[model samples]
Target: MSHADAGPDDDHPHEECGVIGVWNVADAAALTALGLHALQHRGQEATGIVTFDGARFHSHRGLGLVGDNFSDARVIARLPGTRAIGHNRYATTGETILRNVQPLFADFEFGGLAVGHNGNLTNAQALRRALVRRGCLFQSTTDSEVFIHLIAISLYSSITDRLIDALKQVSGAYSLVALSDQALYGVRDPLGVRPLILGRIGGGPGGWVLASETCALEIVGAEFVRDIEPGEIVVINDAGVHSIKPFSRQNSRFCVFEYIYFARPDSVMDGMAVYEARKRIGAELARESRVPADVIVPVPDSGVPAAMGYALESGIEFELGIIRNHYIGRTFIEPTDQIRNLGVKLKHSANRGVLAGKRVVLVDDSIVRGTTSRKIVEMVRAAGAAEVHMRISSPPTTHSCFYGIDTPERDQLLAAHHDLAQMTELIGADSLAFISLDGLYRALGKPGRDPASPAYCDACFTGSYPIALSDHDAAPERQLSLLASAP
Candidate 1:
């Protein structure tokens, strides 16, 4: 089978990465490397770091996890500086290769700038096309590079002014950390579509820290200060922190999926607990939609919390029906269809004794392409589940996500193609129900809230993209065709 069809869950959406930047530290590269390791779950395809050693900049980038990428002593030893920015990426806009790994460094008239980006740019295609028409060259397909070019051409009197000017023209989600020879800069887009937090370590020799999640700060022993406000920029230098607020106050619409799937459960974003939010989603699922069953079983990992909530709320018995093999690496390859048939079995195995002759209710976070749900259902039935029902904690994902998530095309979404009854048949489930959109928002503690609030961005469910699509239209037909041709 092709890579796209190799496993049922292979096509599920993937969020990009975690970014961490530090200003003026003795071992900037090493420190940033450790920070990236702590935030590695945000992305795992590749890692990169750029450091400013006062006089010049140094960089090391490669395709692999943080440990693998920085494993070579020669590579680590080569990067030296007191100010640095780092990135751990799971490719969303570009191919998973070394060339696309970031901490994208460039040299312009203003000197050198290195950036680590944590979210998607909705207007990148249009901007790139405009730049190309104006005689600019691009080395990678990633949208993050466009920001560098935008900064390169801004006709401001100083580097900071240029950075601000460049930011004004771009739209969409971004939580960025940039390092220059003399300073470190952190910025959040106007709508606050992504998360970026500020923190500080010790004193005197102490430095400022910028990261995508607050957990990274805790891991690095930094005290959390606050989130960098939307449309705001914070620059850290020898003189201390300087703040710039250029855009008008607009409604904030942070992506809700960060709490549901992307973030480390231990992290806090905008004061909401990721783990608590997920557990609440499960509780809401139980209140809004409960299925008759002898046992409640989660899909493993992401599905565990919601399952607990479902079990608790419904007063149903919860059992560990599936066992996950934590040691399976992304690169672990099985050579044939027979071995591949054991895909779910390899990653998760059913407990026949627990599920045998039992009516079961399986809880999963969401169903994107629907391939995995089918296999999961078949596995449970094979393990002697007399009747199997499916419950989802989140609303059906029908629209494609453009904000740094690797969701499949609109046509590829099972919800977009089938209703609940149709989906039940497709997945071989006796019954299926998803939490209502309102129910999900209420679970997140944003019930009846205005859609434009910073509380949540439900674009994947509602199709209300805050940024104008025309601004960065890359020709949807062309993009879809490419995906259709995926191997």
Candidate 2:
């Protein structure tokens, strides 16, 4: 089922998109679909794939899961090509209409180019306004459409140069995969705020893969090559792969939340294993906030790894105090108000045998609006929990994300408005604790976050945005013009 149907208590920050591209592989569209299935966790609202054969380009986009859209053999057969690019969309920037489903393709003087982007642009609105003023008609409301318009109007001679020219005028975090007649292109934003990894389909001189995570590489039987460096672009063609660094080098501010929650546990990014990083974060949380309890209970799914780590570190027993139902679908009928109120139970149910008459420590990744946290806490208490202690693996998410994550506005965030005690009381917990920011860094193998130049983007916790929110700031009175330089 989709996130929208995951019950009323499904309150976690959402990743906006995931992108994958394949070059030199036979039935590349099918492989691209497999990679998208692996990245389905990143975004589930929509999926699309664009393929280029020797003759022409083909595309198929739908407003649902990748399997629902691409599992049919007929669909794959229709997209006959040796190169392909795909996108999984969750719609943080645009409506979930068919047009917004991406791998957005366009015809230009140079050739046809299909682009799949995995991050948000901070200045897209302003740029779109300028483009409209210059008589450029827009087809979609997505910020990603700005890239097409910019490239369409570029003064460069070659497609590569035109793309570089277009990138120079935008501000935001992005891991982009664009397919052209000449080659398959992958690019990461200057600050490296998102993830992009390179892989080889086989051994030496084989088909190449560019995806949002290493798990996608694994799913396609590809060998992990290396992470695409921030501010670098790689072009894959018949001859070989070529690299270009169009922007000045800068320290990366990769999104820290990816390790904490956004990425799949099996995935790896920036040389760190996501599952191991999460377990370490859990151990750090246990060390920082040790509370005596009979058992440690995870919120389930995302919280499972951290709970295991916390149990080991705290010397507490771990049990399946919460069981999740994987078969629940969006079409489940809520015939009455009572059934509607039981939505949380449709996806999650408290294991009374494990929780009854026990002091439970509920380990979860993070608390967003606290509605889900409250519901889960109440369910445990109702199951006869002696005392409920909540421990969060990450620091309080105090601010909204503007770089591809779907977070509530600042005011709606629970931590943004409440103190620890207030939050605990509101969530019906005996106590609550979150891992310190320094502890989180330590878990990631750092001494501590250097305020002068932090190792990762902890902007959601500190409200210190690494990239300027050009569009957000300009929305009030339109005081600033579009920023043409990378942040």
Candidate 3:
């Protein structure tokens, strides 16, 4: 079964990708498959693995879950190599198909190169147009493919230099793992809006690994070493792991949404556990929006931990008032709108006995479009809850994300279009409250988001995007030359 439970009404921010790389392992491909499985929450649409044998590079990519694609021994055996890289894709940047399945591979003049990227490149369209003008042929529609074109066109001497050249020209969040015939490179963008970590296996002569989260490292039996510093590159090979800082350092703006929804609960990000951070968020929310309720009811699955934290903090009883159907898959044949609207019941059923005559407080991570939240609220009210108060662990999602997350446009986002009162009415809740921006940072163990040194990227809440939206802001006839510095 898929670790991530989904339904037809899963209208929330979609995750982008999960990347893993291993060097000098006997079961490199197999270990990568396992790592991707552990990080499956970050993506679900497709899976791909690229292996480098002593003689040649082998690749296997397909449109499905990791288990669906890499379950067969034949598939892993087909990719025999001492080193490999893999990707779990969610189609945040490109269409969902076999072609868009990554670690995208290309044969350069130097040798074979495979790239696994975990964030969006903001300036890809401009770069693609420029590359095409310079006679570069494209294989995939993915923005990540532009890196290959840039690297291919560079007059730099070494592979690392060419990669640096390509990276310098682009803008936005990324935690990239790139593997060539001789070396594996792990790089995080200057802003560090995404996550990447390095790990060490038990043995030597290339026991180093790179993954999107610590959970992937644990799954591969690799000990966590450290997070790849923002604007830093670590090149791993038979010799050892070497760190290179090619770009100017900037304040790290790690995505706050990762702790709230994207990352696995078991994973640790930059010295803090994701589950603990979420619980802290819940406690903060309880303090900010205290409501008179007999029981604290979670939205199930992701909201369970937070609900417990809220209950503990607010002195309310935490109960499973809503039961989730974990077996429900993402794809379901819908015959009509009536059946589609029944998606909430298909994935979740309200426990009438627990909710009857009780003032229940519903705790959830965040409401994207308020579609599912509305359905869940209506379902609970129908189940006899006297009053349903909705509490969100994060700030209102007022802006769309351009840094890997698949969020609706500003016009489509419910929070962007409506005020709290309007949103409360739309979601059919007695009251609605989302955590404040400062409260979110407090959950991460900080006093608050310091204006001078804001740590996490709260762009979805504040609309202060650190990276430029090149494509989104470009004029139809604006032929910007991205061959220079950052566009």
| TM-score against truth, every candidate | 0.92, 0.96, 0.95
Candidate 3 lDDT by residue in tens digits, 82-134: 89999999886768867778999999999989998989998899999999999
| Predictions: Cα RMSD each | 3.9, 3.3, 3.6
Please write out the lDDT profile of model 2 over residues 222-276, one tens digit for every residue.
Answer: 9898999999999999887899999998999999999999888998989999999
Off by over 4 Å in 2: 1-8, 333-338, 477-487
**Candidate 2: worst 10 consecutive residues by lDDT?**
478-487
Clash number for model 2? 0
- Model 1 off-target regions past 4 Å? 1-8, 72-74, 203-206, 334-338, 449-454, 471-487
How displaced is residue 40 in candidate 2, in Å?
Answer: 0.4
Query: How far in Å is the alpha carbon of 173 misplaced in model 2?
Result: 0.8
Candidate 1 residue lDDT tens string, 1-487: 1112223335466777789998866777877888898888778888999988889999999887889877666777898877889998878788976678898989987788998898887777788889889877887788888988888878786878988988888877888999887789999988888889998865656588999998888777788988999888999998888999989998778888887777777888888888888888888898887877899998887788788888988999999898777766544536766766667667778889989999999998888988778988999999999999999877888878878777887879898768888999999999998988888888888754465453678777777677766543457775564344332
Model 2 lDDT at residue 157: 91
Steric overlap count per candidate: 1, 0, 0
